[model samples]
Each structure stands twice: as structure tokens, then as C-alpha cells.
Target: MNPPADADSPARQIDARIAALGDWRGETLARMRALVHEAGPEVIETVKWGGVPVWEHAGILCTGETYKAVVKLTFARGAALDDPTGLFNASLEGNTRRAIDIREGETPDADAFKALVRAAAALNASKRKPARR
Candidate 1:
């Protein structure tokens, strides 16, 4: 039987996920999440594909996927956004999505990462259709 949908809100689910991790992966995800929020205060948080943490503004900004050795943050429109800081080290071959894979003991540059988040949000905003006059 299919399990029931998570009753907790997105924020609560994220909090529980981090707490359940109880390790460096959890810490890293939490830090990145905070940076995402700080960079885009209007961004909305949600859970998708069962447990993946998703952040969005006008559209989906990114998804935080945790793995055994790395925490992957995949930006939906990454290929469209400029990566001046070169934070995207994975999924480079993809035509659309780009990802920043943070390994254990490795940390992403906060300022650069935040800048990327803002860029993504801006991209999403740009794509939004204007209201009919």
C-alpha cells in the first residue's frame, strides 16, 4: 500500500529530515537552506518527489538531494543562468539542469552560492508572464 503523504508542512518536513540525518550531511543541507532563504526572502519551500526539498520563487529554483557522499543542489534553470563563480561542478553535460555537489568535509563559497540563488530567482521572475491589462 502507498504510504500516506507527509502531514507536516514543508518547513517542518525539512527540519525533521535534517534532524534525522544527525550528521555532516544534515548540517550542510541546513546551512545551504539558510543561505537560500537569506538570498531570496520571498522564496517558497516545499517537498517533492516524496522527500526532496524544493525552493521556489516565480518558479522552481532548486532541489536539495542528499546522497551517501554528497549533497546535490540542482537548479532547474541552471543552464540559463550565468555561473560566474563556477559553483556548478556536476551535471554539466545536461542541457538544462546544473548541480552543485558538495562532498563531505567540503564547503561551497557562501557569497558565490547566494549570488547564484539570487540569479536563479531573478531568472524565474523574468520568465513570468505579465497580467492581462
Candidate 2:
């Protein structure tokens, strides 16, 4: 039997996932991660659902789910945010979540995506109560 895999930290696990993909999906996931950081520097990255990358500020901002054909970025509070650029396409029927599915040879508008990230962060912050001293 093969030896057990090294126990990597969540960020490193996310890095390993991107590197293991080694295709357009990897590139897309990497790009998406960068945009999340650029858009919301305060947000922290975490691994969830057996390896999915999740970005959180005051709460969950979004999740990075990579599949064979597309990389889906699902914003937790997406349905509550505005999408003037019409970035959200998939998961539209949902009331709380919205997703942007990026397939091979497609690129998301960085500015619009960043706007959504910021809006999600703001929404999360608004829901938090100030710390009592």
C-alpha cells in the first residue's frame, strides 16, 4: 500500500489542488483565487467540503469548486448582491446562492468580479455586531 499523503495546511492544500489540476481548470482556479484576494484582501481562505477553497471575511464570501468542464465560483450571499454586469449565470434559481461558471477559453471580467467580492464582504460586515467592551 502507498504511504499516506502529507498533511498539508489548508492554503497549501488549495495550492496542491490547483497544481494537480495542471490544466485550464488550474489556471482558472488560480486566477479566481487572485481576484478574490485582490478584491477582498481582508478575506481569509479556507478548505471545505473535502477540498473546495472558500473565502471568508465576516462570513463565507464564496467557494471555488472546480469540475471537469468548468470552475464554478459560488457567492454565499450572491442573490442579495447586485449584478449590473450580469456576471451570474448559473444557480440563478437559488434564493441565497449565485454562481459564475467559467469554462475553457472563457475569462471573467476582473472588475465586475471584484465588485461582487467587495459587495459580498460589505454584506457580511453589515450583518456583524460590534464587539462589546
TM-score of each: 0.92, 0.92
Report the lDDT tens digits of candidate 2 across residue range 1-133. Answer: 1213555766778888999999999999999999998998777888999999999999999999999899999999999999999999999998999999999999999999999999999999999999999
The TM-score that candidate 1 achieves is: 0.92
What is the lDDT for 38 in model 2? 93
Error of 1 at 119 (Å): 0.4
Count of clashes, each model: 0, 0
lDDT of 2: 0.92
Candidate 2 matches the true fold with a TM-score of 0.92
Q: Rate the local accuracy (lDDT) of all candidates.
A: 0.93, 0.92
lDDT of 1 by residue, 1-133 (tens): 1223665878888888988999999999999999999999888998999899999999899999999999999999999989988999999998999999999999999999999999999999999999899
Q: Give residue 121's lDDT in candidate 2 (0 to 100).
A: 98
Q: After superposition, how far is residue 33 of candidate 2 from its true place, in Å?
A: 0.4
